[model samples]
Target: MLLLEKGIGGKSLLDIVKVVHLTKRIIPLFWGAFLSIFILFLPGRVWAIQNSYKVGIEDVLSITVWGEPELDKTVVVAQDGTINYPLLGNIAVAGYTVKEIDELITRLLAADYLVNPQVDVMVKEYRSQKVLVLGEVLHPGLYILTGPTSLLEIISRAGGVSDKVGNQVSILRSPVEERKIKDNEHASTSVEEKEAKSILIDLEELLKGRDLAKNIYLEPGDIVFLAGKKDTNISEQQVYISGRVQKPGAYEYQKGLTALNACIMAGGFDK
Candidate 1:
């Protein structure tokens, strides 16, 4: 009985090993199939997200009406957040999404000109809402916003922070009321004199994910400026170790470096 039990136990172990090996071989194929499906559906998901993006000023749009080729037109949103469509005159579409625009145009066309008109709206170019990122960041420049973008997202789009980035970040945003007044052409000189509101954030806390509230959603026409650790230029960073030191010359200056360390790097004392 002992011999039979031992033989059965050995067979069970062999079967377990074979099953584990088979599972290992099958797992890769299963993941490959899953990844293929994900890849196939990624473009559709991206299109859905982009389609929901609100139209803004200076954004180029392509409007097409089915069965009416003459009605197909490419138009650009004006500064006042309006577009001129043929027979429709000036239509406000700054804050409306592409789907909303399509529905609106379809409804208007059916009400007056055509019966059951089908309309399609597509964003040809994104130029309306933009933010400027500068100072202590890699590739600092202006970036266009597709949707609701956060401060961190714009910073990431500018290629993240540089090595010399400091602990503080400043965001300059125009007042909402001021912008509204300006848009209406009723802004006074006093409103123009009012500077943009400055928001200071602790970069250390933000980067560590400790103060998530500091990662506020950025607005269009906002300016982001990142502070630096030192104001000195890289070319001007040098330590002159001349007195009583061997190989005394200009040594590269680094943060928290002391005179003793500089002397040591210069080959110690002259003796």
Candidate 2:
């Protein structure tokens, strides 16, 4: 009835009783408009995070040229971080993203060959960025990180950490980290270094926080290590049972195993 007074018309008193309405129907439309404006003009914009990789030495990339198969090629990044293309002969590709590489190739081709060439550069082999697991890992070795990979992921790939090892582990960021620590005094030190010493990526922290960001992005020749914890002295503990036991076996005496439990395991002196 109050809404009818505000122009929400009802047929009669009986109709008004039946049609209990609120303010103008435009209220929903107004709210919808407000929501739209809020979303569109939001101060902070959320962006889709992208995983990027820097091309490195010895990495192999496959270059595809649409409608120009002759220009298509597979080239290994040289020790000096360069590649030999058809016309671009010995172009440096390291430190450039795949998109940048494509643009570079397109520019090179348009300058001489095609009017507007389509260049596609893909990492056929990601030998450039490999995760190296060493020290106390069950299967410590070099693991190729083809795509998105993390500390726990790499550890799982390496057959999980050795039971003897503790949660303490470290990840060394690749060539950059190496160069950063070197005596290249002329090199400009970036913010990464200021945080590198004490804030080097810790595996324990990653395991706790479940945050992949805590785990450093692995690169070629990056070394990861699992530190060993205190050893359990199994040599000193021993258990022996003597009697008419079925399938009798010697069980190692552990922290809390009792004589009765050991006997029960050995068929309990069968009558």
Score each candidate by Cα lDDT.
0.60, 0.51
lDDT of 1 by residue, 1-271 (tens): 0000001111110000010000111122333343344335545555674677777768899998989999999999876667888877877776678987797788778878899998989988887666656555565556777766777767767666666666778776633222212121111112232334678899888766699799888866565777666652444345444534576566665543432344468785443
Q: Which residue pairs in model 1 clash with each other?
A: none
Best by TM-score: 1
lDDT of 2: 0.51
TM-score of each model, paired residue for residue? 0.60, 0.54
- Prediction 1 global C-alpha lDDT: 0.60
Using lDDT, give the best candidate's number: 1
What CA RMSD would you report for each candidate? 23.0, 26.2
lDDT of 2 at 98: 73
Candidate 2, number of clashes: 0
